[model samples]
Target: MDLPVGHIVTVLEEMGIFEDDSEPPFEHWLVGRLEGLAPGIRSEAERWTRVLRDGGPRSLPRREGTVWLSLNQVCLALLEWSNRYDHLREVTRDDVLAHVKTLHGHQRRDQPVALRSLFTWAKRQGVIFRNLTSRIKVGQNEYAVLQPLLPEQVERSVAAALTPAARLVLAAVRAARVAQIAVLVLDDVDLGNRRLIIAGRARPLDDLTLKLLADRLPTGDAGGRAPRTSTTPTRPAVPATTGSARRCKDRTPPLERLRVDRQLEETLTHGPDPLHLAEVFGLDEKTAMRYADSARALLEQDAESGFSRDTRQGGNE
Candidate 1:
């Protein structure tokens, strides 16, 4: 069973291991643990242990707990695959790939990151001539299919929103994610120009969105001009909007789903062009392509169903 690094460190401290002046207690303990391994493997593991302990030349310093966690993952990988090679320098890209394939779920994803960190530091330190894990890719590729919410569902959700802030969140979902909405400040809103700067990109505000924003803004003075404040207030937390959606009588989709639905609507209005999606939503190329492909597939399916319906009608005539 695995124990936390803190527990292990406390136990070691109690044993008076830290009293020694020869080397750091953690490094000494790590080396002692790897004593059963081959000399070549143990030597490389020790190098990594020291590198992690000291925080390598190019890397930012990490806390003691973080250092131990990272070192644990890297050391485990090295020890497990020790039989395949005598030294880390002898390990090739194929060796790294083979090791990574043995892991499952989060381990499969995170082990590569640990390996990259180790090899990158090793290369910079001249311990290894090349970073073998540089080209290796992990994690999922295909995006999950997002079903757009119906127009009636959106209408009900809008009507159900009780607070001006909640309404603002619902309106902003057309352009920004929940995270972006949560961080929105008064400076990001341009009521006079009818635009909102979302994630550093200017999104044109629709009339409903504009009205919702106006509802949230402070009331004007007796002369009718809006009062200017020295400091801007941030929008409400994510829970504010999510709570509003949860309170709806009918099942309203989460903010993210609503955002996807809005994107699909945009694709339907314009065309399923990745470039257009990227510019409008400020999404990366890969994400834009995924959305574009999803929209295109949806359009094709609709066309096929329409053609089938036309054929059935002609047969009936």
Candidate 2:
């Protein structure tokens, strides 16, 4: 009853254990296991699978004395174990060692390491948590528990998409009386061929971000039920610098513009991306870019004065 390597490989192949590219076209684990199997062990396993597939009134295969398990069987067993112990606490190395020993009906065996390998596989696929804690030590082993990302961290991670200003605007819109925030849609705010979507009535956003939001918004009415008209708005005959801020005129003046002007300038000048710049300065994409461009231009025009230019101008710190 000596198992041949080829026969063992064949059995594993039937069980889908090997990858398609395996040299012998067997399951992934077959190659590694082949070393332990006696020659011709694989042919015997192949015969077993063939008999089962033929449905020739043969008894079902038994695992009692078998050293081989198919890929599907391994998966099924792990899944069943997971479901049964879904509420269990984090598994320490010792806990895993115990489970493997118990599941395989062995005592004082290398079950703990085996269980760890299985858990590692599951953890990589996000099926289970991989905690990294130094709290417990079993035979010189340490463990950690897996947990979901915190809400605050998640918010910070994606905060780049919604600039601080955008976030503020969103907050205002959500908190404002719905009646006061009517007709919130993307539109050409400056009428300079640049478009924007109005987000909140609490305060106005600069042009770059407004344009980005307007461009990205779904084209439709509220509730996503109505189709939007495709007509583009016409450009204004004359563009006006409607905002209160005026460019600096001094060859070298003191602090000028709003308190956040320096931060805004830094954001625009060196942000990794327009969107990133917007988030850094709390402005939207278009406004962020526009501000960056404007800042550079204004500073260049007044380059003689350098960065520490005219104070008392609007937004001057």
Every model: Cα RMSD to truth = 10.9, 22.8
- Scanning candidate 2 in windows of ten residues, the lowest lDDT window is 237-246
The regions of model 1 sitting more than 4 angstroms off are 1-95, 103-117, 134-140, 191-194, 206-208, 218-252, 307-317
Clashing pairs in 1: none
TM-score of 1: 0.57
Instruction: Give the alpha carbon lDDT tens digit for every residue of 1-317 in model 1.
Output: 57666768789999878554567677676766676666776787667766676766666567677666676666667876686777778878887888888888777777788788888877887779999998888766446664556556666667777776578777777678766776666666777776778888877665556666777676545543234565535533233565554453244666666677667666655778989878878989988888888877777877987743233222211
lDDT of 2 by residue, 83-154 (tens): 444322333445443444444323222333333333443454354467322222223222222122233432
Structural similarity to truth (TM-score) of each candidate: 0.57, 0.20
Identify the leading candidate in terms of TM-score.
Answer: 1
